[model samples]
Target: MNAKDPITVLPTDTAVSQRAARELLSSIEQAQRSFGVASVVLTGGTIGIQVLRDVRAFVENGFTEADFSKVEFWFGDERFVARASDERNEKQAREALLDHVGVPEDRIHAMGAAGEFETVEEAAEAYARELTAHAAADSTLPRFDVLLLGMGPDGHIASLFPGTGLIDAQGLTTAVRDSPKPPPERVSLTRSTISSAREVWLVVTGEGKADPVAAAFAGEPADVVPAGAVAGVESTRWFLDEAAHSKAAERGA
Candidate 1:
């Protein structure tokens, strides 16, 4: 209820990243135990990438039970850039965690690279087909065990920026030809697909994100702060640091 009711506010960005590491491992284990396979939808951003590094640190620091080889890694959104480009979320995530964890190439379902497809629409359609291919019997989309999303200062999640028609985009994935941020072309999972996860966690930090975080917690409409429209089938978690939670704390959220 109320999208997890009260959000989890950590003390710092490091603290938020550390908690994300723990949450991901715990959720992965749970999912693996129940479904025999675990899936994670990753995001891109400062804190998002840090979360992966933190997870790697956990494994390096004697978390013997940490096994990601079987986990399916998916991207909530990806820059339709060259596969080797640093702008691509897949490349960043692989360098940060997947490479270190030995998740293998097949388990890493990255969206189309820039030159692989003729257009962003083709890339998005390809990603949608991939998801459908991995779906449960009679299901149109795969079961995403843990979906991590990063919210922008403007409260945008994935490629669904505020005031864009993509906010209400249907189906599994959508192609963005024009993004407010740089690298205009991108492929992103729709809000419908994001909400399909068993656990959807919003990992956000910094003072610049304070206003929109507060607005989302205040139940603002999706058109205003898209984060408000996000949740999961089992749980919707809000992870924030002190600076990002400042305004929400002021409002008694």
Candidate 2:
């Protein structure tokens, strides 16, 4: 889908998160009904984690139904930190939603942790192999029903920072070193890999994000704004709160 597609703006961060929860459940439910199993790429950030928390609440409060067990969970990116570290997205996600939903342990495809591999490159390679293992026949990667992402204020997405070669990296997953945002070491799906998903959602919030949101939607180069570098094979969507959408709206996005 074109980058010029749909943009959903909510009045508040809470409202945006709640709406994202509903969207997530609907995506998973549709995939499960069609093939009995669904796959989604999870992202991490203030809004990203909030959305997961909202999803759990929605399911528990009966606002929606979700077969979390029927869905495979994968991280879009991971800090190459100790498994129990607070910087680990896998750890945060587990505490936020995975545990609450009682999703099958085997279905969570987390990246290799700090202690699990000798090097960040090894961790990234291992994750790529893990993805290959779950891939559909005749393919090297699993079908992602929904690929969620949280954009950095600088317009980076999924660890692919602007002005870095990682923004145009090749392969399914790659190791990130010297990240502008720390825990310098990380593992992330490549930009090309992220774009391979059936649906991609860039969920962002806050006034701090307005500048890059504007630049990205304006068709900036990948080297200048990694967020604009990729698009889903089927659909690409921008989910933002009022503040985050401000500049983009001004640009007539």
Candidate 3:
């Protein structure tokens, strides 16, 4: 896929849900055709969970389980305080999709559990080292085929909230502290690194997200709501349900 103008909106949540499923399947097909392997990054939140669940069902519904074996999974961002076994993004993913599916253990590289590292900084450094070591032999960075993300009501993604120091990071990952949201500690991929992905897909819903969704696509250039930094090397998509898109058309109108 190539970078294009913002996709204004989807008709409803059901439509958004169905499109997410098709998109993941298409990513799998494209990766298989292009690189012989497909790598996907996952996020956590309402729509995030919906996307995963939908994919799991899609795969179960004959999308081909064999394709999953060739897929590698990564996290877009992670909390620094919760154990991976806790009910967080990585945990939910393992329970909801990975564990239930056939993606190999080695192929699923999740962030460290809260207590795995002595400090968030250590955690961030460890993840960075992992990514750097896994970089393609010819390139220091690997272009993720697809990165599924969710927008915070305040416009955050991963742990890259607005006004956070991590926003300016040149590294792949960074330690965050005192996050405005609870469980203040977190590790997140920086904007520079995230922008390296081949495609960035945002699944946002609800009236609460309408303003920020409109703002980010409207070229507001604000960083506090980190989603405003919505850019990717190849493509960026806003897969918004009606609630999130309600204000979008008006913004254009």
Candidate 4:
């Protein structure tokens, strides 16, 4: 779907998380049925973590684990901190789902953490190499079946904040420095790389995100709202809570 025409799926704050969990499982099942394996890119944030937890609950409630083993997980961005740091997205995901899901260790690809690389730039380069090695023959990115993302109140997606040069970054991954958010350093997939996915879901919640959500759907410039810059090859979905869609509702979107 186009940036101005994302498929908006609005459910209540509590319901959205449950729905996202179910959809994620269904998507993985569908991808594995069509291909031998399924690849997914995960995001990190309040609602993002909730979705992971919900997925774990769904599994604990007698959902089959076989399909989950065929899935590969990746992060959209990561804090350039110690691997075990709470700031690390991968660490949060592991505590929420990966550790409980039984996904293969080799298939869980995380960005380089502090102490593993000399600098954020080095970490970014290493991640780019890893992605390149796994990319399809004719593409520079993996054929990701589903890519999940969360938008910050200021319109940042992953680690690409508005007005930053990284918003227009052109590689598989880029090092982020002086980030407006804490830790100030991160590694993220570029817009080009994220756009290569088959499906992208912007899972947003809370009233703070209402304005940016509307702006993105209205086609605001990427420099003003980085979330407006990315879309999936086959589909772009905006999974939101009612509070998050308030502005969009006002604009009749």
**RMSD in order of candidates:** 1.2, 1.1, 2.2, 1.4
**What's the lDDT of the predicted structure labeled candidate 2?**
0.90
Q: Please give, for residues 109-167, the per-residue lDDT of candidate 3 as tens digits.
A: 87876777889889888888888877876766665888888889888888888776556
TM-score comparison, 2 vs 4, better candidate: 2
Each candidate's lDDT (Cα)? 0.90, 0.90, 0.79, 0.88
Stretches of candidate 3 above 4 Å error?
Answer: 1-3, 6-8, 64-66, 82-85
Q: How are the candidates ranked when ordered by TM-score, highest leading?
A: 2, 1, 4, 3
Off by over 4 Å in 1: 1-3
Residue 60's lDDT within candidate 4 is: 89
Pairs in steric clash, model 3? 162-224, 163-224
What's the lDDT for residue 63 in model 4? 76
- Candidate 2 per-residue lDDT, tens place, 131-230, comes to 9999887889999989999999898998999888788788999999899999899999998889889999999899999999899888888888888778
lDDT of 1 at 213: 88
Residue-by-residue lDDT tens digits, candidate 1, 101-181 = 778789999999989999999999999999999997778988898899999988899999989878799889999999999
Distance (Å) between predicted and true CA of 78, model 4? Answer: 0.3
**How many clashes show up per model?**
0, 0, 2, 0
